[model samples]
Target: MIASYEMKHQVPYYECDATGHQTLAMLFRLLILASEDHSDALGVGTAKIKEYDGGWVIINYAGDVDRLPRENETVTIKTYVEAYNRFFVVRTFEVYDADGKQLVKVKGMFAFMNLTTRKVASIPEPLIVPYQSEESRRLPKVARPQLMANDLAWERLDYRVRFFDIDLNNHVNNAVYFDWLLDPLGGEFLRHHRLVNLKMKYDHEVRAGEKVDSQFIKIEEKNQIITHHQIQCQGKIAAEAEFEWKLV
Candidate 1:
C-alpha cells in the first residue's frame, strides 16, 4: 500500500493573481483537491462519507510557503494521514516544483460530522483502518490563529454567500473563506505583497444566502505584515485567520 499519495497539477491562469503567481487562496484550493484525491485513494472519500451520512470538515489549517508557483508551472502535491482519533484526523501536505524543490508545507485538522446532526462523529473503523494511519486517543491539534482585537479599528467588507461558494457538504467552502478574509485588503496590498505563512480556524459554518462581514487589521512587523481576519455571520464568528506576508 502506498504510504502517501501524490499528484501533479499545472498552475492555471485563473488561479493566479495580478502578480502572476498563484494566490494564497488558490494554493489552499489546490491543497484541498490533493487531499480529496488522497482520500479517494484511501477509500474514504465523498462516496465513503455518504455511506455514513457524514462529511469531513476542516477545523484548523496552518502552512508555510517558501514560494508560490507561477502560472502554467507544474507542481506536485503530496499528502499523507499523520494521525487520527475517534473524532478528528491530522493530515500533512507538501508541494514541490517540477524540479522537486519544495514550495510549501501544510498541516490540517479535520472532523467527520454527521450531516443530520451537524456534530462530530466517530470515524468508522472501516474508514480509519484502510489507510493504516496511526490512531491516537486525543484529537490532533493545530495552533489557533491569533484573534483580532475587538477594539481595534478594522476594515470591514460585506458579502452575501453565493452558490459557487457552497461545496458538496452544503456549506461555504473552506477555501472561499480565504477570499472573504483577504479581499478586504484591496489590490494594492495584494499586488505588492506575497503570503509567506498563514493559520486559520473555522468556528462556524455559513450557509448560502447568509450575509457575512469580513473584518481585518494589518500590523507591520520588521520584515513581515501580519493581518488578522474575522468573518462573522448572523452575529457569530464564522471563521478567523492570520496571514503573514512579505514584500516581494
Candidate 2:
C-alpha cells in the first residue's frame, strides 16, 4: 500500500456559504489542494511532470461529501493510490475530523497529457514506477452508473447559461456540471444530508447558447438518489448523467 499523505486545513470564511457550511465549490478546492499535496509527496509534482513533457488532468471523478466542515473547523485530508489501468490512474481521498472519522471520499480518473499538444500520452516511466510499486489501489467500488433502461421519469428545471458558467475553455467547465446536477434538489437536500457519492457522464458538449434542463429522481428503496440530466436540442439527450447520493 502507498503511504498515506495527510494535509490539515481550516475551513476558510470564503469557502462557506451564508449558512456557514462549506460550499460545493470549496469542496472541489479542498480536493485540488489534497491532490497537490499527494503529487508533491511522490516527487512527481506539477513542475516535474511538466519537465517530463507531460502533466496529469482530471478526466472524470466521483465524490461523496458526507458532512460539510463548518467555518474555522480544522480538518485533515488523507489520500492514497487505489489502483490504475493502462490509460488512467485512479486515486482516492478521504476528508476526516481531526480525530479521524471520514467525512468525504473522492475518486478521480486522470490521464497524462502532452500539454503542448493537448493530447493524451503514456504516463512517463518515472511517474508510473513509483505509483505502481505500491500495493494495487482500486476505485471505491461504487455501483456502476445506470443508463436509462427504459423511458425513465425525471423532474426538469431549465437554467440559463451565463458568462460566469463559461470558463477559460470558452464552454461550461466540467466542474460546473456538479452545480447543475445538485441545484434542482434545492437548498434543503444539500443542507440536510451529506452527499455520499456521485457519478457524472458527459455524453455531449454544453455550449453557451443552450439552456440546460436539470432532472432529478429519488430511489427511496436504495436510500439512493439518481438524476438524468440533459441539454436537449430538438429533443435529444445532449449530456447524460446518473448521480448516486446516499444520505449521511
Best by lDDT: 1
Q: What is the C-alpha lDDT of each candidate?
A: 0.88, 0.69
lDDT of 1 at 131: 68
RMSD of each: 1.7, 3.8
TM-score for each prediction?
0.94, 0.75
In candidate 2, which residue ranges exceed 4 Å CA deviation?
1-3, 51-53, 63-65, 114-119, 130-143, 160-163, 166-173, 202-211, 222-248
Give the per-residue lDDT digits (tens) of candidate 1, residues 1-248.
Answer: 43688989998999988889997778888888888888798788889878999888899998888988999999999988888888888888899998999999889998888989989999888877876778877755677789867899989999999999998768888888888998999999988888888899999989988999999999997876899999999999999999899887
lDDT of 2 by residue, 6-67 (tens): 88999989888766878766777677678777788788888788797887766656667667
Model 1 weakest lDDT span, ten residues long: 136-145
Q: Deviation in angstroms for 232 in model 2?
A: 6.6
Scored against the true structure, residue 50 in model 2 reaches a CA lDDT of: 74
